[model samples]
Target: MIYKVLASILLLLVIIGGWSWTEYQSARNTLAVPGEQVSIDIKKGDSFDNITHKLIAQNVNIKPFWFKVVAMQEKATTKIKIGEYVLKGGMTAPELLAVLVSGKQKQYSITFPEGWAFKEILQEIAKNSYIEHTLTDSTIDFSALMAKLKVEKNHPEGLFFPDTYFFEKNTTDIAILKRAYDKMQVVLNEEWGKKEANLPLKSPYEALILASIVEKETGAKVERPLIAGVFTRRLEIGMLLQTDPTVIYGMGDNYQGNITLKDLRTPTTYNTYTIKGLPPTPIALPGRDAIVATLHPAAGDSLYFVARGDGSGTHVFSASLKDHNAAVNTHQRKAN
Candidate 1:
């Protein structure tokens, strides 16, 4: 009787071992998505069961029990990250498990062009589906926000760098803003260190102000340093920067595209013509090229510039008001 019991126990053990081996083979060899790719969004706080259900919901034929066992065996249950993932055709259960364990998520991008206003930047953030929108009028107290971000300035304008930023899903607007802000800080500091001798700018902030002016002056990449030259020369000579862009910015929403004599004569902190110095803050976000151009401006005697008006975005540089007036008249005739 004891021999019979021992034989029965040995048979049961062999049966169980065979079943486990077959299950392992099935998991390693079977493709969850046979011929087509599948996309799944594993949200934050999703459990292993939830992820399995999501895969099944996408018509992937994964065996949930075996998948859970594989995940546990590989210690990938807690390693899975949240984001959109793609499973390609003929991806086996083990391959899918490897992907989830790797924690690679889908990336999205947002771009901020030079001279974008703070409002426009916020609008772009608001419209993006991948970013987490945490900013609202209710949460924004300018002073508090600045304090929270540890920015020394009182305003948020021109603080964030203009660049294309990529991030995973659920990234907050503040997080993106912080990245841009830190980039600006590093770039501005590096450029400030390389600034030409006898610069009129007293600080990096002043250089940023001039750079923003240069950014608004022209879109031609080659002309940035030339425009910076004009402003730097004017500042050094104590000449009023009669640039129309500053006046337009000063006019705010009241500026209806045309800068009348009234707008130019209006007194505002941003009006370079009236202020006789750099604006109290940056008027718009400037790119790294503009910042670099301002710090290392082109060497020239030109202090005035007018639109070339031949439908070319280039400007005609002038050493005196007489030449500038002539260019203006020529531009006016072309406009007529």
Candidate 2:
């Protein structure tokens, strides 16, 4: 009778050990088919049970009992962060738990291209569905918005850097704007310290104003320094900038894709054609290259430039009005 009892006890111990080994092996195996991907969102106040159910709902092939055991063993049962996470097919239970505790959420990106205006930046931000929209009105008061961003400047134009920014889901528009603004500040200051001597710009802001003009002037990469040279010389000689982009900006919504003589004659704060000096603020967001070109203008005697008008965006530079007129006539005649 004692031998039978002992045999039964040994059999029970063996069954328990086998079951434990199976569960441990399951924990180490992949939860989903190889190469499959799943996205899961863990919300605030979500319990471990809730997370398990969500994984199952997404066909993650996770066994709740073994998953909990693994989580307990890793001491990550309460460490899962609340955000969107991507689970790959080949991830084991331990690997998934590590990701949950790592707090490295999936990221989304938004890009602000070079030469974009403040309004254009606002429009692009509005189009992103993942970003949380705090400023509903595109025409919100600039002063209040700048204040909210902790920026001392009254105008927000040219303050934010033009670059691709990544953020987690539901990041606020203001938060991204602040990041861009801070980046621009750091970059502008660093570049300003290394600027060329004898520049007519009195402040970093003036360089920004000129840089914005350079950005809007041409799409040709090589022409930026040349354009900056012409503008800088014009400033040095007390000549009217007479640039068409400034006129278009001054005209605001009145511009119709073409600049007329009368439009150039009309004066506004931004109209370099009539204004004696740099505009009150930047007309658009200038990239780092534009800023650099403006600060370190190419050494040249050319005071005038016009588009070549032969399908190439290259411009013909002239040192005298006569040569400029000839180039303009030649290009205009071809265009006509």
Winning model by TM-score: 2
Error of 1 at 332 (Å): 3.5
Clashes per model (N, Cα, C within 3 A): 0, 0
The digit string of per-residue lDDT tens for model 1 on 21-42 reads 8997787678778567777888
In terms of lDDT, model 2 sits at 0.90
| Candidate 2 structure quality by residue, lDDT tens digits, 195-269 | 999999999889999999999998787899999999999999999898888888878899879988888888899
* Cα lDDT, all candidates: 0.87, 0.90
lDDT computed for candidate 1? 0.87
The window of 10 residues in a row where model 2 has the poorest summed lDDT is 27-36
- Off by more than 4 A, model 2: 31-34
TM-score of 1: 0.90
